[model samples]
Target: MTVTTDTARLPLLLTTLLLPTVARLWPAIGATADAEGWPAAKTLATLLEHEVAERASRRIQRHLIEARLPSGKTLDTFDFAAVPMVSRARIAALAEGDSWLAKGTNILCFGPPGVGKTHLSSALGHALIDAGYRVLFTRTTDLVQHLQTARQELKLASAIEKLDKYHLLVLDDLSYVQKSQAETSVLFELISARYERRSLFITANQPFGAWDSVFPDPAMTVAAIDRLVHHAIILEMNTDSYRRKSAQARAVTSDPGTTAHPN
Candidate 1:
């Protein structure tokens, strides 16, 4: 159907009037009310959409964790906003090839127990997953125990290989339990295999100097430390215990149904 210029402009006028509906139909396109706002908003919105898509893609990456740790948790449940220093920029940087995740480097979150070291490490694992990296989370004790079992079944090498497959491996509670000679050997072998080929995220109550105690063999300790710390980011998180603080807060705020004792 052929229409005059004036009549054609009428439909354009209708579309302009119905721009809100148009915007709703294509939210990704980011149509704004103001003519000047639409261009800039569209560009910014496109970038934001790409960023969210990349994040969502990483979130779907497969991850597994040993369940023995009482508070074992995934990055999915982590509260990134609650962590003051964990910015998206840091997460993004780590996701890049030059960072720990890409370089197969180790990330050590060393501090006292009950702090958010595990949480922060798990959150980074989650962020790396969002960036399309495979991650595994496990307590050091649980992992050693599993490897011990794997050794009995003559699958120790297989288990270690499985761990190496992950782009990033998270070993939480590294110093919580003492290691057996066999467990330490197995762990050292695992770390050695992944050296320069994958990344590790470890949370330990003990400092680097104290880690030697975990590895009884002096030579093995040196070797493990060399591989683990060659390209490492040590996040010395010194925050107060979240669990203790929360418990204190709960004690201060008595439950309405419970009877309170006299102070």
Candidate 2:
């Protein structure tokens, strides 16, 4: 097929205007427009729709990369059957993030180790990111250490403020943070800063009553708990450890001499 003069110039004109998608797809779009006898407005609308979709796709990809969530931890992969107490419908609704995140509502997950708190939190982070909300996932101790370093350099406030861009911050293993004034002070400041402003999704092995070990100071512990629980959704997962159960199942499966009896 011979290229028309106007068609040959269209790609250059579109590229000059910084519309890369339109420039790239103009040939196919032109072919479709001619075959379908589309009006000028329809052809232009088709080009714009593709451009908008391409930009949205690129933005989502960038947000996912910055989120830093763990791999293979999505809502589909989570075993809701194992954790009967947590409602699958509730989780799916929360993942949409329209009601809670917009109101700066926090999510607190309390449980013993290996009960899938980390898994659930990371899964939510992944979902929230896919839903077009910016998210950040970090271990409590690691983030505290970074904040401590920032404080030492007199940049703590700036560092904390930088995190405001994230709609949801996922802090995994809050109990692992050391109980020291330096560590706890910075952690408290972070919680205080984000209180009623941005959302936090936290997974902690310790309950509120035992948080003195985390904050060291009684007043700070109470204050932190007050802010977190004020407008929060609390999920208590007190079941047996998933890892322990998996280990036991593997052991039983490996023992060939074990026989199955009729019920």
**What is each predicted model's overall lDDT from 0 to 1?**
0.68, 0.90
Instruction: Let me know the TM-score candidate 2 reaches against the reference structure.
Output: 0.92
Give the TM-scores of the predictions, in the order they appear. 0.65, 0.92
Top candidate (TM-score): 2
What's the C-alpha lDDT at position 69 in model 2? 88
Lowest-sum lDDT 10-residue window in model 1: 61-70
In model 2, where do residues sit more than 4 Å from their true spots?
Answer: 1-5, 259-263
lDDT of 1 by residue, 76-111 (tens): 565555455556566557655355555677787787
Scored against the true structure, residue 63 in model 2 reaches a CA lDDT of 90
Alpha-carbon lDDT of model 2: 0.90
Candidate 2: residue 5 Cα off by (Å): 8.0
